[model samples]
Target: MASVTFRHTSVTYPDGSLGLADIGLEVREGEFMALIGPSGSGKTTLLRTLAGFITPSQGEVLIGDEVVAAPGRSVPVERRGLGMVFQQHAVWPHMSVEQNIAYPLKLAGAGRAERRARVAEVLELVGLGGFGSRRPSQLSGGQRQRVALARAIVRKPRVLLLDEALSALDEPLRADLRAQLQAMSKQLGLTVVHVTHDRSEALAIADRIAVLDGGRLQQIGAPDELIERPASPFVARFLGDATLLRGRLENGLFHAEQVPLAVPAARITPGAPDSTQASMDVTSASGPASRGPASSSSAADGPVNRNAPLTGLLAVRPEQFRLTAVEGSPADDAAGETPAGTSPVNGGAGNTPSGGNAADHLTNAPSSRDASTATGPGARVTSGDDDPPPALIPASAPARVLSSLYGRHSCSARIEWSGLEFSCETALWRPQPGQAVRVDVTAGTFYPLSAAGSTPAARQEGEHAA
Candidate 1:
């Protein structure tokens, strides 16, 4: 097995169009690295460059310590010690599986007996034992694909490249094949680079994923890291169903038109001059709740300035939002009476009220009262005492359900609040359209609009400021 590296690699076509732009990445030996992006995002171009089908216009391509591609010089594809599978299972209809698997060995001048032994070995390895004599026309699509895989690995090449190898199969078949491919790679300790457009597939199969867009490399990391801490708005939107809200960060809170949420201090990275502290108090609906000391000296992590208000974007995933039905709302009382066993405050016997605390329904949420409170745009709620109430701290916002999609396990609702639409997961509560709901954001990641190293497209997409 061998590691692969691309250093400052670029590909410029004859029409002056750029296919890859200054790409740099490394695939460790025996690592399953997945390359993923939308169409025209340079994923295939990078793979082709590595396979010697396309030479880099600049920079170098190295396999292990040997520089195989550099500028005008290149290595022949046949001598690269790489095996590749494409979207189409290009098996010959007239050739038997054994003949197909043995073709490479024949080209290498292996004797007949040796070729037969190697073909039998790989056939059993790919779970196609004793099916070698079956013609491609007689085999199922999945079997044909297995034959293709067997042919590719028969040579025992150092690197295996898979370009949408399972895309042609059905979902169940694709899943089965994916599991098989993953096991095969590990069992053989093969260095693999898989190019795929399926986000879930890449997340499930690869050790690390590299994202690309507009001929440039986007963020690359483990699946959880990309989902939890995306480097840019595009990554957040692409990798999952995340809603980007235009807002400003002030006093350690993210404030939109009507949605006010306490930003987790850990998500705040230090970059701006205004950043000088790392901790901030998270205010609940009732009153101020102490998070920790606000002094930068006490923070174990570096400082993050929350004193100055900065325009930015907040990315919220569906699961991170807790939705609670509003009490006495038109949708809830549309029948002109409360449901048989439910009430306004404490849900009655064997009943769950729409107005009940959201935490009672979802396991991952805090109490709806403790999470946030619905307030109008720029409206502040006080303790309702004679003395002046503390400044309105970040909490929750009121929303109206626009549509609902019922899944087998949960229901996802499209909600509108302050002229912004968000997709939220409603656990066990089937909210109807036009129902008034309260949206409580349990967690969110903030990215300043002016953050450095962000792509122009990302900045433009995240500029949904109200």
Candidate 2:
């Protein structure tokens, strides 16, 4: 497979202040690698750097053994032997499909006959075999993008760079095009680097994902590897729902403000960072833990190192979990009871440990519902309840439903938790406005997230730091 490597890459904008830093990476040939993160994360910048549009202030970018770029030296965007598709498709709207696809060939001085033949091949390759005479506007968004793809590959470059080329399309269409991109890469053996801010998009298409935050590489690894095991709390939140808890590890168990979690002591644990004063937004209650260093995922092939040989954990993924109503009986407590901490995890938002066990601990004691009511740190149900507190909640009720949005086959409700309101996606059928209803999350779903930078709480502190 072709390998694209970056060594200590950094970029500084004209205005200055770290556009990108300490970037080092390797992407296998015929692989789809996504550089993902929030807006200022340098995903687009990284793509531009690799494509030779922006010169790195330091370090190098390489494709296989050849050095494509090194500091001030660049091969020139055109001569870089790379195919690039931009957010706008970069297609000549007035030009016919054949003309656009043949532009690269024409620039290379391919004869009329040769260019025509190559255009035919690529047009078909992009599923536009007979549409060569069509203009850009004559095609659908997907078609235009396909034409852009055809044009990029006409030269048969070693690497393809996509700068959110399909982000503008609807979700369903994007999914179809993503599969097309993957298939094209496999058949042609082309190495590609794609950039986007959408987490699900990146995870679905990437052979590996590089998490960027404020122009810095936060973490990197295959999709599942990064998702199920983010290294830092930041990562846990950014990847998706990360139910963070403020706690310290002592005596093999983890005790947050008061919640207890069963951490596999034998496996890697969240690095003991300074716990002097920590706060969590409680983004996600439970899910799988996250790890860093960009681990490879078994989803790409078969099973991965299922025998946990890794570390740097913080729960993050939703699929890697099960549900439970409450804590189970002692007979079922195989992980053993949490080493009760000095305080209990209480308070609606910012709860402190009261320093006593005799008090009602905010112990995530899921009520015994459906025998399956297991208990873990991410206990969802309030200790005493079974099924959402009997719909006593009304508009003027304790918890009022704020907004409702419909999804393909499911729906989500924005519930006011405490004085703060957040979104919770569910399949439950509930009414509008003044509707009072009880809500509950899965206990097993709430768990500790890494300290790595995930989505900030209601308020954040970071490069956007003050």
Candidate 3:
């Protein structure tokens, strides 16, 4: 296995279109890093540059300590010890599975006996041990993909590159192949760079993920960090489903729908704990956030904004909103909304003690507008030992449920409030469409995203222009 490195690497098409712009990153030895982005985001270009299929316009591309590509310098694709699996299966249609897998060994002039041994070994590695005699045409789509994978790894190349290799299969088959591929990587100790547009797929398989937009690197991080503490509004929305609400920032707090919420100082201004710090110790000694390649234009590398009264955005994931039915209202939810003096937000009587029912405590909680509004999501409220932990703040307005979709483990409920529509995930109960429900906002479940204009569309435009 070999580590990959790009030192200020960039790529430009002959027509003057920028492919990659000053990308500096390192993939540690035996690490699995995934490149994810939208169309024309330069994910494939970066992969191709590493494969020696494209030459860098500036800087150097290195595998191990050898310079493979740079301005006016190049290495042939065949000379690079890399295995590539493309979106399309490139297996020989007329050849048997064993023959297809053995072709690489044959090209290297291996003897018949050794070729047979290697073929058998890889077939088993890909879970196709007994299908060596079958042709590509006769095998299922999944089995054919396995054949492609087996062939790619048959030679034990130093690095494996997969470009949307599983995009063509059904969901179940894709999931199964992902499992197999992950297993193969672990058992073989393969260093892999996979490119895909599917966010969940990358999150599921990659040790670290590099997010791209247009042709620029947005962020590189583990799945949870990016989800919980996104650096920018674009990153927050791109990673998954997010509700972004426009708000005005003042006194280190954001006010939206007349509800005051605290956010990270870095959200509006640069140089604060922005999205770049979203990566954490993601199963590797070399953290992806600190070591992975990042774009030169990232917020972490930009200027600081110490000034206040900025217009920013609020981001919250569906699962973060604690859904509750107002007490003594039309909906017969167990916990009733207590009077202002008795509400949890004002440190009233509704606060549940340690051993009390969890839902009951949440049910009696006050709306966000009624709380102290001193902290953001994941922040803690100081309390005396005798006092019950502060209850979550309720939504500024009670939401009217517009739709509901149920899944096996959870239900998605769409509600409208503050003249905005939001989709929230609820585990305990599924409210009916047109039903009115209350949303509880807490410092433990929300984040302040960046300014509204730093959206995916704007970033894409900037990337293309660069």
Candidate 4:
């Protein structure tokens, strides 16, 4: 019903401690905006500022077009037209659910019949239709929280605020309540701002998420955007399980000293020119020598250089790395020969050639390390199986599995490549520990460490100050 805005807002305590630092963001009308961060990150400070509990030392907080919080003037919390639910379900023990929900309408002088009708409607909305007569003392934790929710929405407020509303409930109940809350917000067209430390919850429900650290806004974007193209290393590490590799970008290819890996610059930097062809050509021509040292100039056969070299970090998630069990030592594959019974796996994203026993191809030959064992947990080892072999990447770096965790549909492995550890996921092939495998970076994002406003010192200062 109403959008929320924080325009250059800041909060400072009496002792000169900063609560928020020049924060600016907007929550669209009828949008579910989630504010997330660690403890003392200023998310709660921002929420309290919007609720009129804390006034901004400078700038202003606006609800729709009205300035509700500003220096020397502020609206009263009771008149802000906001419905709020906190971690604790603050329901009266002696009151029935219907009475608790109707109390807000009673305060506004609504007639008994009108209050009863509104209470009944919200009780049904929160999935407590037939339990309104029960007292809070008799209800389960989840039911009591639902009662708290029904009470908050009974008066049909324009904006709703949830500060860890479901954190006290169990996982299953929390998940169910999250779905119900999303539906309720849409059906009622409420502008909602939810604050939680749970990243998964925010990613699951928010139209957009605002990440804060050290009393400063880190980055705000849709869930996928933050996960795929994080603006900084802190954001990438905070949002998902990403392995950060220090590297340098030369001629549109990322070169790192920790491993023999070269990722196309285009994959790491959005909108960068596609240099996959040039990189592949260079790798084919130079073989393992390409990973040795940086060349002062681009390859004679490579494309013309358009962007300058950059020194920064590369963020690669587990799912972005493709793995293939090496039939023999990497030295054997360097001769460009496919083994006796195995075919060269295609080198494209999500491409798997048909008609091969994956276990046979992976287990038939002796590895140089002699560590290749039988199929791992949940592996299908039958011959003539429909499941195809994993892709054999030509320019992949060599790595050995240190450990593995098997899930229902996928297996995650901890691999050590060139003295660096990385986490990778495999869905089709189950690689055992000490097994030699080729690790290829299927996709990654590069962040220039020298970029403005993304300095590590600034992030560290914020974290420490918070």
Candidate 5:
């Protein structure tokens, strides 16, 4: 196991564009660090730097105590003691599985017996024990990927570099491979740096997540830590489903404009004793907010509003929203974006809280509008002779059961409440078109992301122009 470290690392390309700048990070030995962001976020660039594929214009790239990448002297990729898997399964098509796995051993000039034994061991490690003799062309996509993995670390390199190795697979196949990789990492004690843009992939697999944007590293930490407490607005919005609600704090305690809400932990690391519930906007895709001293609510709303302690930005996950068929009790807004004294759940009723947006509940929230709704033939709505066809759309805002799909053992529901699309998985649901569905959102998780830092994009752009 070898720790990979980068300090003051910066990179530039022949096109005069900057790839990265002021990079500083450390990947602990034997830990999995998943670097994620959009295509140009420099995730791949960082991985290449670690693999000794790209040279930096400034700074140090160190593995253990050795300075592998820096000014003047540099190490080559093969000499770096790192295992690498590319986006394409870079296995030699003509080589048999056994041959491919054993190739690394041969490269290191191990004798035939040792090479064969290591090949057998790694093939089983990647779950291809029985297919040793098959060539790459004979395997399924998953199988081929397994072969590729077997080849990557067959020599037991100190670190493993995965460059979106599973991005080409379908969702289910990708999920399966993710599990296998996780298991393999633990068993092998391999330090890993995986690069991808898939949010779910990063969330499910990473021990530490490094958010990169525009070729710069934004924030790095554990999965829940970054999601629940983002260091900036960019980080919050980039990682997952999150919406930014603009609000302000009054007198350093309550948010203005919306119902009274407390400052976020980012704002007041120690929320007062009375602060309890953090609110969010469900459609907003905000993450969890920090715990503070405020009246606790029944549930968290979108990290958008509930986590709305003092809102710069909120990240709300879809699963965090609580669905309701009927009206819910009123509560106060933490993010000042809500109307003064507004409660997110139920807008009106003496029992409800006051001062939220008077717009129809489905109007402002995006997830309420779904593109799909799951319904079976038998579950279709039948028109009665005496009843004029009920309006699928509301008088002003429309709600429709749009698109839905059924899997072998489960199904997903999609509905258009206002204009946004929101989907959820279920055991079974057969809601017909024009079915009146009441969506009562309980709350969302809020993550207070950093708003002050420069994203990789900015640095890259600046470097190119400079």
Candidate 6:
């Protein structure tokens, strides 16, 4: 097993197209790390750099403390002692499965008997035991992929690199192969760096995940850390079902043109003469809470001032918002009434509560919600039927349903509110096209972002496609 390290590495094309920028990371021996991001996010470039296919223009790349890439040095791909699996599978069609898997061993000048033994062992390892004599054209797509995987690992290299290796397979096949890959990595103590745009796949397979965007390293942490407490709006939106709103931070409140959102704290001081400390505090509804710094007041308090003029953004995940039907509104006509026990909150989206202890009262609730059933039009289901209704906080944003798409049990509704379109998930209840829905931005996980002198940008729907 071997470890990989990037020391402020960067890669830039001759035409000034940046591929990677000042990335520094460390992957421990036998660690499984996933690189995930949108298109043009440098995930593939980073993987290529590790495999010695692309040399860095600045800094260095190391594998097991040996410099493989740097400004003045380069290691040939073959001498790096690594195995790579590409998206195309790349199995030789004319060769039998055993021949293909043993090709690497033969090239390394292994004895005939040893090559045969290793081929047979790996054939069984990838579940192709009896199919070793079959040609690539005679096997299914999944089987062909297995052959390619076996070929990559036949020589037992120090590291394994997968660049969208499973993107070409169907969902069921992909799942099966993913499980196999994980098992193989653990069983062989292999160090792996897998790259893909699928956040869920990365989360499910990797021990640690690194998120990159625009050729820059955004965040690297465990799956839950990135999902629950993202360091940036881009990271949050890219990794999960999030709705980002452009707004400003003033007195610990997020103020959009037509929405009122509250966050745990304001950590950015606009044009401040002095620097302030920043930290992350995430409290999931059912999961354990995490905070970066110690505090007596609340986990949300940070170094920035409570009252400052800072333009920024807010990221609210789908599960963070509690959907409620707006009462006495034009769009409410299409909304059904609340169930007998549930109660509707007072006021519109703009009438949200300001700072003070309101942030505390609004954010703390049951850690989990029970499944709820929809009974009437516009009637929103709380987390569970037994739990009392959520506190009566005004709507953070009032929206009109533009369209509703049903899934197996949940529904995704395209809502228009304050000139912004949000593809947020709601309860299984199907709302009419014009139905009124009030979104409550619950306290604990509402993330407030400072513009940091950047442009107003938000992640669009379906950015997670692999």
TM-score of candidate 1 to 2 decimals = 0.75
Tens digits of per-residue lDDT for model 3, 1-466? 8999999988988999999988888888888899997677799999999998889989999998999999998988877888989998888998999999998889989999999999999988898888999889999888998899988888898899999999988989899999889988988899999999888899999988888765667777777666665665557656756555444444323355323333322122221144432221111112111222332333323222334333334555575455567554444342222211111233222332222211222233332333433433222222222222234322255778888898765578887765556767765357778776766533221222223225443233222210
Q: How well is each residue in 333-389 modelled by candidate 6, as lDDT tens digits?
A: 323323321222211222223332223223332223323344454455333332232
Give lDDT per model, in order. Answer: 0.67, 0.57, 0.64, 0.66, 0.56, 0.65
Ranking of all candidate structures by their lDDT, best first:
1, 4, 6, 3, 2, 5
TM-score against native, each model: 0.75, 0.66, 0.74, 0.73, 0.65, 0.74
Question: How would you encode candidate 2's per-residue C-alpha lDDT over 1-466 as one tens digit per residue?
Answer: 3578989999987888777787888898788899988777788888888888888999998888888888778988777788888888778988999999999899899999999999999988888999999999999998998999999899998889888888878878889998888888888988889888778888887889988776666678889767654644556667855544334322222333322233312122232122111112233233222222222111112222322221122332332222111222111222112211101221221121322111111232233333223354323323222322223211122345577676653345565534444444433232244444433222221222223333232113222110
Q: Which residue runs of candidate 6 sit more than 4 Å off their true CA positions?
A: 248-253, 260-311, 326-398, 443-466
Estimate candidate 6's alpha-carbon lDDT, on a 0 to 1 scale.
Answer: 0.65
Which scores better on TM-score, 3 or 4? 3
| Local lDDT at 228 for model 2 | 50
Whole-structure CA lDDT of model 4 = 0.66
* Residue range 1-466, candidate 5, lDDT tens digits: 7999999999988898978877899999989999987677688899888888788989999998889999666898888998888778878888898998888889899999998888888888888888998888999888888888888888888899998888889878889999989988998888999998788888898899998765666678899877665654455556745433333322222121221222211112211112122222223223223222111221122222322232222233333222222222221221111111111321111111112211111122222211112244212121122211124212222234455465654344565654545553323244444444444222233322212213332222222210
Query: How large is the C-alpha RMSD of every model relative to the true structure?
Result: 11.8, 11.7, 10.4, 12.3, 12.9, 9.2
Which candidate comes out best when scored by TM-score? 1
| Model 3 stretches astray by more than 4 angstroms | 249-253, 257-311, 326-395, 443-466
Could you tell me which 10 consecutive residues in candidate 4 have the lowest summed lDDT?
Answer: 275-284
Q: What is the alpha-carbon lDDT of model 1 when measured against the actual structure?
A: 0.67
Deviation in angstroms for 447 in model 1?
Answer: 0.8
Residue 107 in model 5: lDDT: 85
Clash totals in order: 1, 39, 11, 0, 75, 4
Q: List the residue pairs that clash in candidate 1.
A: 275-305
